[model samples]
Target: MNITFQKNAVTLLGTPLKEGEKMPDFTVCDNSLQEVKGGDLSGVRIFAVVPSLDTGVCDLEIKRFNEKASQYPDVKLYAVSLDLPFAQARWCGANGVNAVTTLSDYRERDFGRVTGTLIQELSLLTRAIFLVDDDNVVRYVEYVPEITDHPDYDTLEQKLNQVIRAQ
Candidate 1:
């Protein structure tokens, strides 16, 4: 069974995305499994952090961002993963992570597909970071090519600062 992976030139995951482009609206599940849509997050800068959450790098990334999220109270940080809502809640509870909002995209919402983070053969979401402005415009995007690598935090932080300053 040769499954042809639908590739999009959007970014690393082959989803069609570009810098300065308006981000597409989406609805994902929050920690409580409640529906969370893009509109619900209007008027706030969004730090969309995609991670597998089952790997060491992903764990570190979330931990680091969770700590840093506190410094930017104005921004809404969302840690997105394909993990089930139950797993997300359990992880948050076990780790005492409450600073950043945790979201799950595994309810057939195709968030991984839309974000271009879905691994074609592995059924996993690739690690990516998208910084969206309050108006839902994509200001910055970083998709690490290697699954084991971490995102470029320096550049991401720089763009985040710029967006915050612009507001």
Candidate 2:
């Protein structure tokens, strides 16, 4: 699906992940620059995709998730972005963000291309969220229609609650 950035139409590369489909395989870098693959993560996971950590919208998204994460200890929160691992680490440290782990898609657009969150024009990820259950099936997917807008946190929280209850 096409989305807008700063109110201008922009293309998102690859097919967006759909609910009930098996989560696609992809790799992202951690703060330490180690490769993290989707297949390696188990249990309920939330991929909080974003463009850059430095941006206000992305910063708020990650901070919100980090704060919300304490309420759902069982769910693993991942903030995926195109920012460098070092930058992510710095942001986390400066902001006291520990509950949510940050993953960088810089080395390769592996996660970006597969999740279809990669913005073709900017080569950055579009804001989106995905809930993957323990079985690796996608339970929820949300792609912000506007790049600058915040996600529907209410709906996302509701879905997460349902997933936790089932777990």
Candidate 3:
């Protein structure tokens, strides 16, 4: 898909995910450098994919999610990126972000390829958010048309509430 990054457009590599589809399983390194399989994560998960943690917007985005993470202790929130595990760890430590988990896809880029957030030219993941239920079924997906734009927070909160109410 064609997604813009501050007016510059780029194409994503794989097919985009849709709601109700099974979440694709992939391997990524955690902040501790431990390999984790997406399928191994149980319960509701919110995956926030970003290009790089060094960027201002991406940094703020992750921090924002981290701030909100405590509201839903049962849910797993992940900040996915192509940054090295060491960098992810450093960033988390420097920012005092302890709630949301950070995963690095630098080695295989599996998370980016599976989620169709891989930006071909940039070799970075495009900005996107996905909410997957306990059954591994995707409950919501937002592929931000503009890579620099933030996902709809209001809708995300509302949808999360709806899911919580249904459970």
User: In TM-score terms, which candidate is top?
Assistant: 2
How well does candidate 2 match the true structure in TM-score terms? 0.98
Which tens-of-lDDT digit does each residue in 62-112 have in candidate 3? Answer: 999999988999998999999999999999999999998999999898988
Candidate order, lDDT descending: 2, 3, 1
Candidates, ranked, TM-score: 2, 3, 1
lDDT of 2 by residue, 1-167 (tens): 76999899999998899999999999889999898988999999999999999999999989999999879998999999999999999999999999999999999898989989989899999999999998999999999999999999999999988988887
- If both were scored by lDDT, which would come out higher, candidate 2 or candidate 3? 2
Q: TM-scores, in order shown?
A: 0.86, 0.98, 0.97
Least accurate 10 contiguous residues by lDDT in model 2: 158-167
Give Cα distance to truth, residue 31, candidate 3, Å.
1.7
TM-score for candidate 3, residues paired by index: 0.97
- Model 2: lDDT equals 0.93
Full-model lDDT for every candidate: 0.73, 0.93, 0.90
lDDT tens digits by residue: candidate 1, 28-128 = 89878888876667655555445567578878888788888878888877888888888888887887778877888888645676667766566667767
